[model samples]
Target: MEDGLLSLKWNNHKITFFEILRVLREKANYTDATIAVEGKFYPVHKLVMSTCSEYFSEIFERTPCKSPVIVLKDVRSQDMDALLDYMYLGEVNVNQNDLASLLKTAECLRIKGLAVPDEDPTKFRKGQSDDRRESPPPKRRRHEDSSSQPLSQRPVSPTISASSKTTPPSRTPPLQHQTSSLPVSQSQDSVHDSIVDPPPMVKVEMEEADDPDDGYSRRDNSYDGGSVNEGDGDFGTELSKSEHDPDNYGSGSFPGPSIQPGGDLPWDEGDSSSFPPEGFSGDLPAGQQPQGAEGLELGWLGGNEAFRCHLCTVSCGSSTQLQRHVMTHTGEKPFSCHYCSHRTARKYNLKIHLRDVHGVPIDRRFARY
Candidate 1:
């Protein structure tokens, strides 16, 4: 074999890539013969043949004399160059895009066999798909994780990736949350007594004004994911006041005990209470603390930072002070076109911009490949 040429001998079959290259160089029968397999057809260039499975055998047998042979669907379409490389060298990685195509092509060409197929193809598909997904199996997860985690926590999500060419999702995370709101009432029923006997048509109660500060439209709070004790809480203002300020005994200062230190705990009560060396010293003093100390703890302030990096989420003492400081090294290109720049990180974003806004020449290259 020449330095760049490849050769292979299997049983009585002999194939040298140099032969095909010489034919191509001479333009002498270089064009592969075409043959139909199942619903599709492809050009078969070399005659090196093999029989592994029935489906493949049928396709291989049907290929006209000069047709080229492919490995699997995984290689034929997307990895055309790799397939060509394999045609010469007989090896390549089977990437996802061309896997099915290479397999289909191989099946068409009978690179495997026409019969003697696996008994349970569903198991085979499930195994391969499961492996490709690399997600925790439902049964394999801990009981809590299995019941609590969403399908996305596994190797894949319930829905396919938006960029996928087909219905079955690709390896990317299903990130976009598409919330579908349901109609409040099945019938066109108003808030009033739309019961058997309609109330008087006079408007009795004034309409409640929508609060500008509270912009979020109230969702149905009665959901499975809602807080278990949302409406009722044992530790209300009474418990909070007692815990934060134990100084107020039962003086007629007010209906409820006066808030001594005032305000609630920073962390959850259980977590904060755990550090109480003696647990609730319960010492109340004459309602007087030092200046700038009411509703504030000397333990806090200047000890540590509060606000964190908006992007990195690291702790920041003061966001205002950090604003210009953040520009020191983050090096993020803050300025960008509003439309396509945010949609993708690729420079070909201009293609999307042109297609979407300017009605310029459109190309589907980035849409998939």
Candidate 2:
């Protein structure tokens, strides 16, 4: 244990020392010698120069001079500067033109670790130049040529030309094709058939034969059970026994088949009066009632046909619509103005109030409504 060897390591010591030497060389500090190249004197450290180059080491060893000013003949100042940088920092940057001169100077100075250039330095350079000249140029692509030209100046492609030159297929008109495919007689017959087509007839089947003079219909008899007599004649009964019965009409006056005003009954035929009134009694048939708050009659909306509001008798197209309608009667202010206590049953109405009363910008979400 007493004779054991110890090794301490500083990984960056080489680089750090090089950096210090470089700084010292730049400042001309601790330089014990001078290197004169091309009439330019560079202060240099003998120890550093001798350590890097054997020629300098031999000169120093032979002369035993403390501080010698070495005169370098046939060497460039720029080359000397590069060599000095190499000696200090272990790296030198020389371009292709100056690299040959730098290498020659380095060889003459016997600078260690400086790579020697090839005997014929131009061979590789000549080969590179020749390769660049001899290598085939990239083939001109069709698309590249077309793209290089202005769009209007570009030549029309063969595909486009062929398409342009080629004529489109001639096609028969639909009516002509249909008619031509059939025989001439058949074509005329079809035309005649279309022109002579009969109007659709809706036959009204009844349990008893009806007299046009009497206003009674199957609908009236369906609701009034005791009014129609059993002796009523159907199409299957004897013609002689098919007698008109006045008692067949309800005991109460016939009432002339009263039609509720402002009712959208099937028989109303889009009459202006059929459009619902402001607040009409919806005491109408199932298919005749007005929708929304105008109709407060819920009895006809039963039988799962229409959605009737519980809060009011207004029938809606759907449950969601009915829920919205019920809000009116319930006075539910589901939507409220953020700026004030004003509230509304509908989002559209709220938007209107905000725009008209509050002067607030309508939210983008409510803009559509």
Q: What is the lDDT of residue 75 in candidate 2?
A: 44
| Tens-place lDDT digits, model 1, residues 1-369 | 468776664653334444554344234243332221111122333342221222222223332222222111111122233233233333333443333433333322222211012222211122123333232211121111123323221111111111222211112222222212211121111111122122211111111221121111111110001001011111111211222111111110100001112212211111111101111111112121222222222222322334321111123455333332222111212223443443332325546665677565676333211
Clashes of 1: 34
lDDT of 2 by residue, 226-267 (tens): 111111112111111112111111011000111223332211
Q: 302 in model 2: Cα distance from truth in Å?
A: 99
Candidate 1: deviation at residue 81, Å?
6.5
State how far residue 18 of model 2 sits from its true place (Å).
1.0
lDDT to native, each model: 0.23, 0.35
Candidate 1 local distance difference test against the native: 0.23
| Separate clash counts for every candidate | 34, 0
Top-scoring candidate (TM-score) = 2
Worst 10 residues of 2 by lDDT: 154-163
